[model samples]
Target chain A: MSESPSQPAQRRTALDALHRTLGATMTDFAGWDMPLRYASEREEHQAVRTRAGLFDLSHMGEITVTGPQAGEVLDYALVGHLSALAVGRARYTMICAADGGIVDDLIVYRLGDQEFMVVANASNAQVVLDAVTGRAARFDAAVRDDRDAYALLAVQGPESPGILKSLTDADLDGLKYYAGLPGTVAGVPALIARTGYTGEDGFELFVAPADAERLWQALTGAGADKGLVPCGLSCRDTLRLEAGMPLYGHELTTALTPFDAGLGRVVKFDKPGDFVGREALTAAAEKAAATPPRKLVGLVAQGRRVPRAGYPVTDASGAVVGEVTSGAPSPTLGVPIAMAYVDAALAAPGSAGVAVDIRGAQEPHEVVALPFYKRER
Target chain B: MSINPEQLRYSKEHEWLSAPEAGVATVGITSHAADALGDVVFVQLPEVGATVSAGETCGELESTKSVSDLYSPVSGEVTEVNQDVVDDPSLVNSAPFEGGWLFKVRESAEGADLLTAAEYDAFIAG
Candidate 1:
């Protein structure tokens, strides 16, 4: 816990004390002292799949773009057609460098006719802030860094809605997926979004930092009898991996384009006017349509050995074909699963001859669809 | 079962070896190692008849988050591996000293580096 002379101190969330009190094993994540797990990561993962899991997502960055041309600015700044996004709705989008390299994948929430909020990964917050600010210079809009202004908490799982219903009077049933509304939850003003990274029916509540503890306690109390557990980043990683969602530093990176990661759908070519990376993304989209150099695919180990991140994937002849980006022993599947970017020819779901180099041994694996698990409606 | 530190020799690599009976000793990772490694998911043990050297890697224990090498505290011939542990790796976390005993080795030599429980405790405390 001692900081080295050259290293800066890790930031602590508003509920840092609460997490420690609950016996969370804290770890450094994206320069923040976040909980890696409260107890067993496997148990936490299973709870999220079966019951409900609460998450402290305050470390995620929130940048607000407001004013007359806010939508116009975002349309020119990100890959998505944000100008067309209706108020109260959210869109999964990405901001790429001029060369089409992914800067970061983002969730843009249109809060008003002329106001939008861009949520970026914690590690890429400042980068995204600078990118959006620079892109908004000529527009009649303002980009504000609201990272420290809010604390985000997520209640995710099948039982999430029932748990949240006890604390919030918001129209939980009418709140469509990817939509948000300003409301009061447990007497605290908040933005309740029906959005989540975990592939579950859940809600993410964004509230003032000062009100975070109260809201968390209220939700915990309400969810106590519903088998809700405070989960940590360890289970979060495995949960998202099982859902086939891409993580910023892992599945998405500056070296890869949206098309390269098989996320070409996030780029809206029909959006009016030129945006950042538009030309390059257009070419990338065309190239992807013809023959993608690498495509992201799911991998299930045929053995017990886990194929972890950065492990090399090989073909039958021992030629390296790809590398694992995110992996874990899926608590749901009871097997090791991973997502990897492999050569296009080997990306098909049932393609044979795929193996992961676990240490020096090439353990055989089967290529499958992107998501290893999906919630049953 | 409960660990009697006085009856066991510990390795700096976080393994615990019991006092030899007829030159055969039971080996498993210490609870501290198990807790640090998190939930153990998979294990690879040296096969029966395989010769392992003191302070050398004899197997691997893969946790959900990461993997660690299992080192033999004594140079010996592997007599048997606990198949129950091989079938259920979580025993390595739940019962590291009992049901999780990885293997029994007939020792030819014990490593001079092995520590008493007190010394091992002090070593890990640092």
Candidate 2:
């Protein structure tokens, strides 16, 4: 799947029955009974393209950090500088190990001067919590796992704003990308963030699971004329892959450093003091300037053949150069595209030719820049 | 969502085979299989001349996130393969019975022992 394996198949949310009714190809992803797709991937993909789509992202992890030094703790624990973030702003940051390996990439939301929320990928919920909890405890800051009480839903696509605005009394006009605010939907309290992974203008709503169904139904019923459709993981993968988004287990992992995954900007070395992995990050930066590990680059298959995950990457001489970490046939681009970590020399765009061992035969490919597709919608 | 066709014999793996009305048996994956796979992006069936036995792996069908083996329900020498389906695999999802058909074989009675649609459903339930 696009995310991590959920531990112990946690409780199902209000959308379980709806998914079954819609005939979703249900699977265990991050311990949630999520939909892969309703019926046709083409139709689902086009819905968000032409109109709006709703997603049940309740399986994601939400952790709250509140203390006098909460900002100071995350500033050191996460790779990005958090001290400059004003209230209601969210920054995508990575938590790195002492050796400069990524533990998880999460969205850090500054609620107030001393209170913050970090939403992590479901599979890495425990990993991020353990890392942050351990670090926050050093400063006596409380790290609470609010995942159990929270249900996350994404209202995505071009028509999302209009459909969702009618249901909420809160003003949704001023909210920009990566912006968040306390809002209400169907008279239930929730946190609305103007961010999504589908390369569309959408919002991520965090509300109680008890109210999830009502809000989802109200939005879906209200947005029906506006072309809003319920999306599953199937279309979700294609959408994010088209947007050049990095998945947890594939692009980012506990073993891979942020620098190796084309995330050098997220690592803040000039934060004025030593943070977690600070020395190693500085050292990795210096080492990378000399010899960067096989760099991550975009791949475009020559034919209709899709380059899959874990497929071996080879050079013109047929020698194994690296491996494809994540790939998919983009429904948006109508072409096969992928992302792989190849030797830094081969990582240069258009400079090298490679082949992916697709199924049994090798298919030719060209390295392109990240984000194989981007649309105004 | 529905049985592929009555005349065609079904396999537990969800393939359908019809004996050649004139010595040419046809083969295609069932509609259920195509739907379960979500979307049919890539199909790798044997060449038109490849010999295949009943219940043997003949080709592969890959979706956005999975790879499944395509098994033949009849034993015969492949006489024709649906190149049209290979070019546009979504046909398999939308038209698994006719346009999405994978390959055809010369008439072989050995392939006739495959399950019927009802029996195949029972096998999946079990």
Candidate 3:
């Protein structure tokens, strides 16, 4: 279906034709025409939790910062102390506006001592590029939009190691978590990083767009016996939600700070030089320690009814105390789980009297610790 | 996908109704609707003895990805709801016509606009 002439067209990934051949149901996500599911969302989700699931993550944004001061520029542009990160390692960080509001949660990979790659959300790619580019105006580094240059794919689950080991010569065993190494996988050049959003032991391969189809076929062929299935974005949402990872638009937004989302640990206050949002975030951090306004907490439904995003969370007296940010029927847990921003006083896990207003009905939900499911290491 | 049974009548809201026997009929969501709502996690049917007006929302079907309104195709009193489908909502996706039949209703009034199987097929195709 085409949009009106005034609306921009949705972008497709390198694997668009392949996804169609596999009978995937496509949906518009963040201006990208991406696969929502291949067969069943629950089955896809369970595959990632039990066996292995492969994902086409080419829709994610990749921005490159290079030069002598690349790391320094990141330190000032984003909240994390990226300059301290060792080569070949990645750090989960965020970029915030001057008002202490988060721009986007990112993963910064230090490819070399003088080069770094910042992975951003699909919807906020341009926003991140603009922010970082402006912040790097005085630094000796150059920022470039590399979104279209790479096709990213991930194989995640318990069997991921075995599945990937068969195709790559890279030291998958020695590649510690959050580490990436340049290598050839199935005769194609790739950056294999032992990082994923599925809360599993996995590898994310960043390869040239031209080689995506071949790489995908090789991975599919190699992973077939290991029980790997091609997954879609629908399952990816549930997987990340179960892992308690905050999505950029949902848990993080320009209206909320990393501190507000309970991600203040990503913001380093003791960095060598001044950084954006430092002053505001420093005060926000102090306020959070003393008396935070709202706190994010995990909510597990006590009933079979699913609690959905934007549903109001109420207290014992039926007063709105919070709002759900992300929620889904957890395939692994077999119950509805959610993440919500509740009033600070009632944010503690196991706090009494919490429920989600599902339509007109008040479905009971228990406040619990986050990460509804954690894979055993 | 299973074709809509010729003996059944369909509504534009994607509900299928079996021919009423003694003023009571079986109702379920069409396979087309079930396919659109992936991996149904929960189904809320109108309670037994509750009156549902035609073309009005009676309940909800919550899938993993979204929630959809379940509309009553005819004005009737819900006589029985399928607890089997409620207990295992995935049945809606697996067997929408048979095991996943949502509810039974004692028809009080007909909508006068139910489509035949062929008409329903053409409607969805369009």
lDDT (Cα, 0-100) at B74 in candidate 1: 93
Q: Model 2 segments beyond 4 Å from truth? A: A1-10, B1-4, B109-113
lDDT, residue A363, candidate 3: 87
Please give the range of 10 consecutive residues that has the lowest summed lDDT in model 1 chain B: B1-10
C-alpha lDDT values of all predictions = 0.93, 0.84, 0.93
By summed lDDT, the worst window of 10 consecutive residues in model 2 chain A runs over: A1-10
Q: What DockQ does predicted model 3 obtain? A: 0.80
User: Per-residue alpha-carbon lDDT of model 3 for A1-377, expressed as tens digits?
Assistant: 66699878889999999999999999998999999999998998988999999999999999999999998899999999999999999999999999999999899999998999999999999999999999999999999999999999999998998988888778898999999989999999999999999888899999999999999999999989888999999999999999998898788899998888999999999998999999999988998888887788999999878888899999999999999999999998898899999998788998889999998888889998888888898
Worst 10-residue lDDT window for candidate 3 chain A reads A1-10
Tell me the tens digit of each residue's lDDT in model 2 across B1-126. 436466778887788887577888888988778888878888988987888888889988878877789988888789988999889988899899989999988855555567876777776666
Please give me the DockQ of candidate 2 compared with the native complex: 0.64
- Candidate 2 C-alpha lDDT tens digits along A1-377: 24446544445767888788877777778777788787777678889877999899988899999998888889878888887898999999999999999888899999888889999998899889988988876785788998887888898888999998988987799887898999898787889899888888889999998898888889888898998888987888888888888999998887878877878889988885568998888888887778878888889988777788899888888778888988877777777889998887777788566888887677899988887877763
Q: TM-score of chain B only, all predictions? A: 0.96, 0.89, 0.96
Candidate 3 regions with alpha-carbon error over 4 angstroms: none
Q: Would you estimate the TM-scores of all the predictions?
A: 0.97, 0.94, 0.97
